[model samples]
Target: MFVKSEYQKKLVHVKDVLSMINSGDHVVSGLAGAEPKAILSELHTAADSLRDVSIITCLPMGNYEFFGNPQYKDSFLMEGWFYSGFMRKLHANKNITFIPNHLHFASTKRLDYKVPRIYMGNCSPVDAHGYVSLGLSAVYEKDMIEKADLVILEVNPNVPRTFGDTLLHYSKVDYFVEADYQMPELPVTEPNEKDKLIGKHIAELIEDGSTIQLGIGGIPNAVAQALKTKKNLGIHTEMFTDGMVDLVECGAVNNSMKTIHPEKMIAAFALGSKKLYDFINDNPSVEIKKGTYVNDPYVIGQNHKMVSINTSIEVDLTGQCCSESIGVRQISGTGGQADTAIGAQLSEDGKSFIALYSTAMIKDKTTGEIIEKSKIVPMLTPGAIVSLSRNDVDYVVTEYGAVSLRGTSVRERVKRLISIAHPKFREELQKEADALMIW
Candidate 1:
């Protein structure tokens, strides 16, 4: 079904198109699990050839070594939606730009117009009938091709043929580059001693038949691992990794009680192992959609028993959630954490939880060196973004225990939050709490 057209008939290396890119060109790529490595490799080669080649990406995974060097600073610039391990270095570098947007808007906002001239993406190899799948990032790339001036489709045999908004006709792709490579599998952080204890406590709070929204990280993954025996659990999350696979296989997550989408798992995106990708392939049980719909606080509130469990870098005695930044540094962004937090609060039987360790890294006077410090700051740094306001937060979970903050007095909120603070700093936190007289 390869039509013989000028742009469609070309059998060129992925690098060749990347080499043709010039300044003022906005280049978009499939971020996270579906990154086109071959095209990226070629783009690196053309770093010096192009000027002001603005590359836009979201939740991108894999090595971004080329973007780090100062030599290519003038040639190419990068922007990220969520900071991955590779893009974390960009926060320190001035050349790179950072945009705080939800995952759903990552592709929709750019693809609805001609801002991005070139679209770099990966897809499952054409099937016997010549159809390719968007693999892990269908929600973003589907709209990219519709709007981009040029679409470079990498046909990787290893990309899973996932279902829901994944199918791409051969005629849609402008250039096809044949490549076979394995999708990257990020190793899940093994639950540490603290994580396991926290996980166990969180697991006990989750009841059977509850609709769950979990954030990414070791604690969330551990919490999922601890709930394998709980029955009839439903997932209505913004994103999920390999941890949910085991729960689904073991019949722990049956999606039976969810009022929104019965018997189907709903999410904005998927990022995990090949098995998770393959499991979603052509699977009618999954619906991948935009963040406006998937992460809408109002829409999530429609579901029954919505349990949103998100993390935080720190929490103030006043119950403010700081998830986007660490003190002054912008390490992450306000993702669907607040969206789901509010959703859980609005659900008739729902509960929103901000879970975190209650300490920061600091120096000890006795030891003459820094050690685990308290993250329960008395007050947020001036101008710090309060992602989850006091009205939005319902529960704060720590290894110490869960503190319910909904409808609690300001004084009570401080008392409850400080109660769970690290022992070394509890008295100091209490002293600050008393001085403020936050009641």
Candidate 2:
């Protein structure tokens, strides 16, 4: 509760802050939409001068030009909970540390660590009281700012001033830099016929009064497209995209039937097209809170009829979901998928869905034959991370069918899962399931 100064503030370029950092210091950038691109660029440029600097954060958006380049390979190290395009490129580099945890817990745990410096990012200008809003990403920034020895501010006027717990007292910031650039805009990839069909089938599982938790990419976008006709649909999700705009306009996402946040759209954060960002700007109907509240199992269960839809890289016949890894390789982290799944199960009339395409490839790896490969595996490869266990999954949706496996015995659940798997892989999956004596 420190009082901020309305004194004539001068903007300090990011290079000034970069020069002040010493070797072996821990610096964490604000997560998601609140990422300070200007500061990050400056740090990248100064990588040669700085050494052994550890950066801990979640999926950082936009172009990452100098993350693990050879010129500064030993300079900066990344400790991340999830993988993005940049992380994929640096997968082989052992310098990048991968920590597996739910997104909600990561946001909360970031505070307990020894933070030498914290970067405070914002989109709006200083108010009368000299407070700045955290824009689309108020989600874990408050904690980062509170526990740091030095607080650096990126004052971007173009960042939207979103509502809810998003304000920061200017006095907390040790350095100020004016950076007015448009936030990163996520592009829309149109859905194909197969994707549209999958979306249609998934849409059928959603009722009028269901509150939803969904992830990103074409599948979630396609599913949102099919939900435009549904009535009173509420969104209590981790992140929203451009697809949600249509549902809101059609009066479908009225949030009237939601038992929690009745008139407000509750989300941890958002990353989407420019229009989507502009739509949420100062819009009171939307409440952009921290992930701690939005992704909490207890908060999500307060709503009646909650339906959590998440994607997976693969699912085993025994119902293990590997959303964060490909076999033994760690591709991402166990994010809010487990949080929402468990939350949906605890709701009074809720259902959790693990949806993905039947096949990722159309070639047989062992037989050297042209055949469809199943994303639904007989068993998860060794050391694969299971974000959602069999007991937590309520339903499994594919283009073929939807199987409910919550209360069913292990043998019965295995049979139901194999039945919904791709037709080409059914026989192989059945043989494998039988070998496990599951049926």
The top-ranked prediction according to lDDT is 2
Give one digit per residue, the lDDT tens place, for model 2 in 1-439. 3234432354567777788677898877776678888877767787777788887767877546557564566888877767777786676665677867787777667656565465546556777767777887756677677777877778888878788777776776777788878888878878776668777888898899899877777788788888888999998988876777778988889889999889898888888888988889878988888888888899999999998989888898778898888767787778799999999988999988888888886555678778657888877868888988877888888888788988888788878988888898889888888887766
lDDT of predicted model 1: 0.77
Candidate 1 residues lying further than 4 Å off, grouped into runs, are 1-10, 106-114, 128-130, 363-368, 437-439
Clashes of each: 8, 1
Q: Which pairs clash in the backbone of model 2?
A: 123-159
The global C-alpha lDDT for each of the candidates, from Candidate 1 onward, is 0.77, 0.79
Task: Locate the minimum summed-lDDT window of 10 residues in model 2.
Answer: 1-10
Write one digit per residue (lDDT tens) for candidate 1, span 1-439: 5334533474578667776687789888886776778877656677766788888777677666558666777777787766666676565666566776655455665555446788888888666566778777654667677788888878888887766666777777778787887787766777776777777877887888899987667888888888898989998888866778778999999898889889988877788767777787777787765555777788899988889989887888879988877556667677778789988888888988888887767667698787887887788866677778877888887778788999988888888988888888999888877787655
